[model samples]
Target: MAVSVYRGFHLQSAPNSTEVWQVKIKNHVLTGNLAAIKKSIDWWCETASLIDPREFESLNAKREESTGALHEDFNGYTLKNDTGAPNAWYCFFNGRLIKGSKLAIQKHIEAYLVAKQRAEAKQAQQKK
Candidate 1:
């Protein structure tokens, strides 16, 4: 079976009774058994989301040391975009992972800008 996420990543299982998933994120391919993959994804969705930014940095550093690659950190989540610009970003944290396309990142960035504008507007009004 093949599953698609973020329009840039796909998960496919090898034909036969194998429980391994071949997850393709742009040009990167990750092959993990079902149990490990599920555990990783579950951790990302459940545990990593609750981690503090400070603690996450420490944890991410360890991940880079072990994995030997730079993973961009965002609010405790590790984002990996090896497929170049305008592609999807694979987010991994707390032993879990997910994929998000450029559009997804843009949406988050836009939201941040809106929040900043709101905060600035409030500050200006208070100073007036």
Candidate 2:
């Protein structure tokens, strides 16, 4: 279907496939992502129709997966109540300032947190 009615995700036909009756998971177009599948499982964990990937060998996620985590959490970063700039968001990370719109501040915080986590993980691996 060429419609956005499917919640989470669904199968859709490829454009200019050069073949008849071919379909692929709609979100796979983005990669081997699993946000949609995880959402489906969240909604219908028991009664609907979802099998746990960890339990079932056939339902394996051999590639990438999305945890569906919210990116807007403060996560140790503090927000400043608009200091003269209209419609702007000021974010402070341990005293360092980052000023922008709300979305920009959130993006910055998410990127910082991800980088920090990666760095710590790498450091631990070096220790090992």
Candidate 3:
């Protein structure tokens, strides 16, 4: 099975500080096994919660908002706008909007893909 990974994050803007936290997954990693991915994502979100409780609350409140919560789709995870279009500036994942350059996201994505592929292969060999 092929794994797909996507990157996502949350952005917080305040008078004094602008903070961003993001995560990237390899292609099909999340989509191929939604349950496992969701659990991993939820765990990450919990970790983020320790950093800023308010951010977690904000995510919970806006859970219904397409861009505010984790989105799982064929194209990959993304932060949707009010119109339900993927936001170019940031992709929301694990309860955050990741703010970074395309290159940065791509690098993370590649690393995740390689790691996931190796892990899946190992699991398959173990099953045999």
lDDT of 3 by residue, 20-71 (tens): 2223443212221233334446655666422223445455456546554333
> What are the per-residue Cα lDDT tens digits for candidate 1 across 1-128?
65535223355777663665765433445566644444444444566432222344455566566553335666544577764444557764335665677457546655766788999999999999
**In terms of TM-score, which candidate is strongest?**
2
RMSD of 1: 17.7
Q: Give one digit per residue, the lDDT tens place, for model 2 in 39-75.
A: 4444454456443323332333322132222223376
TM-score of each: 0.29, 0.37, 0.30
Which 10 consecutive positions of candidate 1 have the poorest summed lDDT?
Answer: 48-57
Task: Indicate the TM-score of model 3.
Answer: 0.30
Give the C-alpha lDDT of model 3: 0.44
Query: What are the runs in model 1 whose C-alpha is more than 4 Å off?
Result: 1-80, 84-87, 90-99
Better of 1 and 2 by lDDT: 1
Comparison by lDDT, 1 against 3, better one: 1
Q: Which candidate has the top score in lDDT?
A: 1
